[model samples]
Target: MSEVLLLLLLLLALGPGASALPKPSGQRQTGPQRNKLLLVSFDGFRWDYDQDVETPELDMISVRGVKAKYITPPMLTMTSPSHFTTITGRWVEDHEVVHNMMFDQKTNLKVPHKETLRRTEWWDTGATPLWITAQNQGLKVGSFHFPGGGAHYSGQPIQRHVFETPGFPDDNETEWRENLDTVLDWFSVEDFDLVTLYFGEPDNVGHQRGPDTPERKDIVRQIDRALGHLRRGIDARNLTHNLNVIVTSDHGMTTVKKRPLVDEIILNKYLPLLKLASFEILDYGGFGILTPRPGREAEVLESLAKVPNITAYSKSQMPYSFHLGRSQRLPPVVIQADLGFNLNSRLIVYVNKGDHGYHSGEMDMKTIFRAFGPDFRQNVVSQPFDSVHIYPLMCRLLQLQPAPHNGSEEVTRALLVQETDGASRLVSSLLLLVSFLFFFV
Candidate 1:
C-alpha cells in the first residue's frame, strides 16, 4: 500500500482514543491576528456542579458549542500538577510538577504553591509549555494568574503575564470582571494569540463550605456570572468569531470524612513519624509523600499500607495510569486517601469540610471541560478524556507546532469543527489517490 494509505489507516484506527500525535496542519499565521485561543480555568469545578446548581451560562455554552462529560486529571491531582498537565500535555512524570507544593528532598524544605510560582528552578525543569512553544513559533501569548505564569520555562517567559495577589478575594464579582476585561484587552489591543486565565473560585468555597454545602452552590452561581461577563467581553471586542474559549478546572472537590464516620489516615498513628521518615508532607487534603530515612524505606511503606481508608505505594509500585512514578521530585513512598478522606499527620487537625488531591478515578474527583468558539462543533458533547489532551488541542487551534507532550489529538479532535474535519477529509482523499497510483502504475 502507499504511505498515504497506510497513514490514513493508522489515523482511522487510532485517532479517536489512542495516544496519537497531531499533525501540523494547513493553518498558518498570516494576518495581524491569527487564530486565537483563550483558556479559562475555574479552580475545583466538579463535573456535576451544574447538576446541583443552575448554571445558565455553562448550559448555554454546551448548547451552542462543545462540552465533555468530564476531564480526568493526573493522579495526585492538585492545582499545580494538573494545570501543568493540561498546558504542557504531559503527565506529572514528564513535567515533574508532582504536587501543589514544591518540595526539596535534600534540604527537606517545601515551598507554598504561590511562592513556588516564582521559583524558576521548579518550573523550568526541561519541559516546554504551550505558551513558550507558541511564542517560539512567533505567536504572542499572555497569562492571567495561571499557575506557573510567573516563572520562566526554557529561559522564555510568556510575553505578558499577571499573578493574583497572595490574599485576593476569591468571590469578588467585580474583581473577576476586571480580570476578564484585562484579558480581553490583551487580545483586542495587544493582539495576543493565546491567553490562559485562571480563577481561584469555587475551589476556595468548596474547601471552606464543603462540596455538598449551599455555600458551594452560591459560589457556582458567582462563577457562572463570571462566565457571562467573559462572553460579553468577547462580544464587545468583536472577537467572537476569532477566539476559541476553553473553560475547565484542575481537579474536583469532595466532602471530607472525619472520625466516627470514616477513619482518616493519620500517619503518625500507624508509624513512628520521627523514626522512619526524614521528611513528611502531610495534613494536606488527600495525599502525602514520605521520604524515608537512608535505610527505612520498606518499614515506611509497610506501616503506611496499614493505614485505613488509604493506599500506599512505593515509587515504582504506583499504578501505571497514575503517571507519577518517574519524577525524581516525588518521594520514595506516596499515600492517597479514599475519595472523601484525607491523609493527616498526628496532632495536625484538618478542619476543612471539602478537599481534593485524591487519585483521579473517583466520580467526585473528575472535573469539568467545556469549549466554545468558531472552531468547535455546536451542541456536541464529547466523551471524557485526560486533561493532558488539552495542550495539543490549543496548539492545533493556534496553528503552532507543539513542544514535546503526552496528549493525543485523536480524543479531542472530535470536539472541533469544519476546519479540523476538512483536514481529515483531505487526508482520506490523498490516501485514495496514492492507492490508485500505486496499483495502476
Candidate 2:
C-alpha cells in the first residue's frame, strides 16, 4: 500500500507535464511545418455579403478550409466591444468594454476613438487577451491596427504592433496592400508566432452608403483583392501549410433611414415624465442608454416603454442572451431601435446610412467566419457561433493555455482535427492507468 501511494504521487506530479504538449491530430503536412497563426478582422463584413459581391480570395479560403455561415457577435455589437470580445473570449460585460465610447460617470471620463486605444484600464481590466497570453508563454505576437493590440496589459505589449491614429486617411488599395506586406514581412523576418491584422472597410463604406448599395460592394471587392495579396505572400514564403489563417469580422452592418425613433418616442412622449441624469446615443442610432436621476428610474422605464420602433430594458431586466448589465459601466436603462430605424440625437445632425448595434439575434447583424490551417479541418461548413469562441480556438492552435474567459472549447471543437502524437497518447494512457489503479487498487 505504501509503494502504491508513492506511485500515485509520482503520477500526480506527471499529470501537468502530460497535458503540456498537444498531440498532432494527423501526419498530413501540405508544406513545411510552421506552427504560426494569423487572425484577420474585416470590419463590418456581413455574413451574406458574398451572395451579392464576388470575393474570390475569401471564397478560395472557404473552399480550402472551414467556413462558418455566420458568427453572431455578442450583444451591443459595436466595434470596440466586439473586437475586444473576439481576442479576450469574454463577453463585453465581463471585459468591461461595454461600448466604443465608454463613459464613466464616476470620473466624468469619456473614452473616444482617439483615447480608446490609450486607456489601459478600460481595456486590461484583468482579462488577458490572446496576444498577451501567447507572449506570456514565450511566443512572439504581432498586431497591425487591431484594437487592444496597441495597449499594454500587465505591463507588456505585443512584441510588434502598429496602431492607426485618429483621422488617418481611409485605407485605399495601396494602403491595404502595404498593410499585408508589412504583416508578411513580420512573419518572415520577425518570425512571429501569432499575428493579427485589421481592415476597416465595408464598415466605413457601408456607413457612408448603406451596405446593400453598390458602393459597399465595391469596397468589398477591394478588400477581397487585398486578401489575395496576403495569400500570395503566404504562398511565396512557403508558410501556407505551417501557418493557420482565420478571417472574420467584428459585426455586420444594416441600412438605417432617418426614422427618428428617439424623437417621436423619448423626446416627445417620455422626456417630461422623468428626471434624467444622462442619456447616451451609442453606435450611430441603433443603441442608447438612459440613466435616470435618483428616484426616477421607474418613471424612465415606464415612459420609454411606450416608444415606437424601440425596445427598452431595465438593467436587471436585460435578456440573458445579451450577457450585459452586470457591469457598472453599463447605464441603468438600455434602449435599442428596431431594424431599419435609428435613434435621433439633438447633438448630432448627420445620421449614418448604415448601423449595427441592434440585437444580435437579427440576421442582419451576423458576420462571416472562415479559417484555414494545419490545426483546422478543411472543406467544412459550420453553423453559426458567437465570435467570443474565437479566442479559445486561437489558444488551441498556438498551444497556449487560455485565460479565464466566457468561451468554451465545446463551441469550436468541430472545426479542429483531433491529432494526437505518440508521446501525447502515451501520457494520456499513463494518466488513465494511474487513475484506474488509484480507484480500484
What digit string (tens of lDDT, one per residue) describes model 1 on residues 56-152? 9999999989999999988867999899999899999999988788888789888988898888888888889888888777778899999988898
TM-score of 2: 0.85
Indicate which candidate wins on lDDT: 1
lDDT of 1 at 5: 64
Q: For candidate 1, what is the total of clashing residue pairs?
A: 0
Local distance difference test, candidate 2? 0.79
TM-score of each model, paired residue for residue? 0.90, 0.85
**Residue 188 accuracy (lDDT) in model 1:** 93
Which one is best on TM-score? 1
Compared with the true structure, model 1 gives a TM-score of 0.90
Q: Local error of candidate 2 at 299, Å?
A: 0.8
What are the per-residue Cα lDDT tens digits for candidate 2 across 17-89? 4342263232322223337899999999999998888888888888888999899999978889999999999
Off by over 4 Å in 1: 1-28, 260-262, 419-441
